[model samples]
Target: SLPAAAIHRGAPGPSVPESPGAAAAAGSLFRPLSAEDGEQRPAEIESLCMNCFRNGVTRLLLTRIPFFKEIIVSSFACDSCSWSNTEIQSAGRIQEQGVRYTLAITSRQDMNREVVKTDCATARIPELDFEIPAFTQKGVLTTIEGIIDRAVAGLEQDQPIRRVTDEEVASKIDEFIGKLKQLKEVHSPFTFIIDDPSGNSFVENPHAPQKDDALVVTHYRRTPQQAAMLGLEVMGSCCSVVSPLHVLQFNTNCPECNAPANTNMKLVQIPHFKEVIIMATNCDSCGHRTNEVKSGGAIEPQGTRITLQITDPSDMTRDILKSETCSVEIPELEFELGMGALGGKFTTLEGLLKDIRDLVERNPFTLGDSSTPGKTEKLQEFIGKLNEIIEGKTKAHFIMDDPAGNSYLQNVYAPEEDPELKVERYERTFEQNEDLGLNDMKTEGYESEGASGR
Candidate 1:
């Protein structure tokens, strides 16, 4: 069947055929016609719907878009299944590079600015550590606030799973939703970023006398990875996997035993936070296995500190999601767990202590004959302390200091009036921010003081 654009529309009856030269000129105009010429030669074509396998109708309307010169607006509807689809395609030739749009949403008015996002565009809110990868949703023409609202809906849809597994994470997701809503109210400041590898997305730029300081537009060549992800590397080929989230497997040599291994990497979405890549590697030759978690999104703004008291056996069951940036401390034992100590993990307090114990046991000095008596005694003492805590035979302080505020400790069941269990959130100091390579973070107008201890 002919496409809707192929069907001709003119003066009510059967249309008179134009000369071959005129048809060739019309085809040329579709590539690069000036706004004036496009307006002078408006075209509309309609045909039976091919989509829905129904005899309904479809229309192709060629019009001059405001900023964009010429575009084809296609619409289709089928009464049989009530199926409908609408898409806009640029008539201009495709560009060789991609475009990126960054808008600083500082006021409520900014939220109302028009935004055009293609299906191949990835949207990000760095401050919120939230991102919507390409192919996650269909192309849309909406406002900044509308995009944020859609993201909120997506996060909300995943709340049930988070609530059952980790209520702390669930509560954090709620906080993030509130922050997004606050942006709609102009109560907070955030940056909105959109990268379209197809160079088809756009953000409205109202030409005002005073240029808007809030908007930044840039164009650049797509990286090889971006090109491959968008299926642009091959001219006429499409990606085998259309979804942005998928498992990837690769072969590698194990770090521990230097044996051949296979690694499976999966993208995991954490409610309220950025997506994470969870990688698990197994060496069949030596039965060696390892796992790691890496963030797939942006770094957090402020820092977080969670302090909990291990007073009873029930406290050992509390879940914790510790980010790689977090530093765990047990002041009672004079022990500290830095980044890469246990890698990033989601485990209970008891499980965390057990992991620490295992690491201590693996230390060369712990089992070496050349080890000094004092060193061995200290290691044994730390192990005994961990065991005591896990057995609920002793009470101790558990502290987690994360400069990115990505780590979490469950506190859903904490007593409201208890002074022992606490969660403290603070602004990252200059040194801390520098250490995290977040020197350009916008901290102006944000509270410099630490949040009152909870």
Candidate 2:
């Protein structure tokens, strides 16, 4: 199945509260139900069932206590309507080496209608399981031999009385059946279901009858193992195929679990937005983290910009690169703030503006030196003074990388600084890399030959 890459590509409507005059008048749409009243059941109804069995000793246990009756209830609501229909059963008065049972059925209509019941006083509820074939289309069982052959294939080879593999295969068949269920075909409204009557088929584990009327209906009163196999068939198949809604519950195969787990990846495609963060990652155990980066000037959809940033030469390249690369991908653009990059190469305002205008003609953005006349030389003097305070001289060491990947320098610093006030000193550290690409070199703080060649 395709991932939800373009789910949010469209613009959304604005949110505003409606006036009180637009509110609807309060009133009940349907009549409320009373304990004694009976009415027509809704199109769909929720149903519940209970069954019980007892041994000789269990019968004796039941006779001694007035309220020691065992009761079990399983409930389900209809898909089309919220009506609740229930089937209740009780193990009646017990006789030595004999069993008695009673069933009470009712729908949401308050009508105490008993749909079906059988008092199996002589028949002992036995454990059983069975398997049946499923088809994508309704009324496809034209040949009896073919249906029997499929049912046989669903059965276990070793155990003839109980089914095993057939259940799993049947599920695969159900996957295709579900797709048909959505179609406007004759079988579209049907669902595959397991129909268990006695509820004693699987010892502690019971098999409930499925309500799907899409395929050929065959009742197999076998052992619980047989019924279990039948269940496996429908489950395996229906689960394999999914709709848009069901995909959310589906898990991707995660290597750690050897099972499918959902992914955090999302696709964003929009022209105006250069980048968008589809998802974020953080180390739950530790504070270390990273983010995704978009390259090739790709903009995210819906004009959403992500965490990716363009590199500026003037900023601390080490910090920026380390922060950006620590997570997923590197950003596309870079900015230079050193001696000669963008419009910042010239010291004068007019010269800087001219450089900027030229840059605007080629690119949409640029950076330039912002120093004014009074502070032009003062800034230089401040750098020198800081160097002397830290190193006891006007000069300090420096290291830089070349923009063209052709040159590099280490341990070079200013040779002059003010020799007066105490200077706060801090060490600079560079990141270690085995192989630095052209983009990586830019972060190493290197200038091009045009600016530093002299």
Candidate 3:
């Protein structure tokens, strides 16, 4: 599979939104190229064509998409056989996480949107129940229509042979091909998905710098198998892997009963964004088990405040990555989980709420002479309200304020706006910086400072 390409270099160009209204939404981002822009020649290299064993030329264009990163698009053509090929390669390094792009195709205009399918990317049409496996046909830089056309061509190519040998299978193939062809007309809406472990695939959005209702993009941590595919994971010594992904175990005392225990500490990468160290301890004497998550990176420069409105029970299933320095707040329930209350956690929204209830009930201050009947009743009422939110019986806003900017709250409705979610990033206040001990930290000129002060 050598990471080959499927885009035909002979394509005049990608289909663009032609309707005036669609063009308006596209703005300068998707505007047609001017003569001056077309005058610029791309870099070229002459090479042997694998098809005809004749000399061919490959042209490379380096361009940056609006509201997106830079990329290189290469087109190759062999004059002898008139064979053409096109490929797209990401100019940036491998991202921290793999990405999944889901696009809802409901109209002809939608089919014109450009797509980048890397060699390691898998494309699927859920409505058709058909999938294009990675490296099956090579990477491609084409439009939604282009991908479907390619599928149609591949299916029809095998029908002739099937009709001669296996008429039964051939008839089924013909029927399936007919259904795939109808999709081109978009008689019914269908989902187009591209899951790329390399995080190199892309689906264009005419409405750039704004949310697209029909598209959703989610970032996910790569599994060991996926990492191995990308050459990021290797066998041999456990230490062969990079930091924040290694396992370390040591002896420790159990917190529950002060008994001897062995704590398993593994610094692992989390799906939300970064790496976190997870510690689990077991006490054989008391049969006690406990696990905890701890931050493994330095404090972020800016602070993050994420607000998610819980309007549906399904929202409870949303993933939440709460860093050690984050605080959870529910104004409607008049409840707040202060910083360091639950330490660091990677769990679902409902799970976090449940933990909050348990932590409050177990608060040492809730016991002794300080605990009054009135206080107990109030606490019980609050817990009940928390349960309602978790059950989606009541609507509420879940807020996480992290001065370290490492926390994350999943948006089930992504690549599009989730009316229920709003996020804001702000500079940390002086007091907040002091609390995180960032004021005393020196990141820049440390060598010079050491030389001078020492």
TM-score of every prediction relative to native = 0.41, 0.12, 0.46
What does candidate 1's lDDT look like per residue over 1-454, in tens digits?
0122322331121111256566444442233223333234333344566655657665555543333334555556676877666665554434446777888888777886667777778999898788999888776656788788888888898899999999999999999888877778877788899998877777754321113467776555566788887656555654653224677888887644344689988877654345667788988755768777666566666788889988888889877778777888888886766543466777788888887787666433242332357757766776777899999999999999988777767764443434556777788888677556567557674554444432
* lDDT against true structure, model 1: 0.66
Model 2 C-alpha lDDT per residue in residues 1-454, reported as the tens digit of each score? 0011211111111111134332112111111222232232222222332121211110000011011122211123333443322221323322111111221112121111111121221111121122242221121101222223333434323343323556556565555444433221322122222233332111000001111122222222234454344343222334432222221232333321122234343333323212222322343322323233223222111111112121222211211111111111111111112211230021222233233234322220111122234433443443344333233332222222222111111101213432321122222123213111222334343466546865
For model 3, what is the alpha-carbon lDDT of residue 39? 41
Ranking of all candidate structures by their TM-score, best first: 3, 1, 2
RMSD, one per candidate, in order: 26.9, 31.9, 22.5
Tell me how many residue pairs clash in candidate 3: 0
Residue 279 of model 1 has an lDDT of: 80
Leading candidate by TM-score: 3
Candidate 1 vs candidate 2, TM-score winner: 1
Instruction: Give the Å error, residue 236, model 3.
Output: 9.8
Candidate 2 residue spans exceeding 4 A from truth: 1-263, 269-271, 274-279, 296-454
The 0-to-1 C-alpha lDDT of every candidate, in the order given, reads 0.66, 0.23, 0.72
Alpha-carbon shift of residue 427 in model 1 (angstroms): 1.5
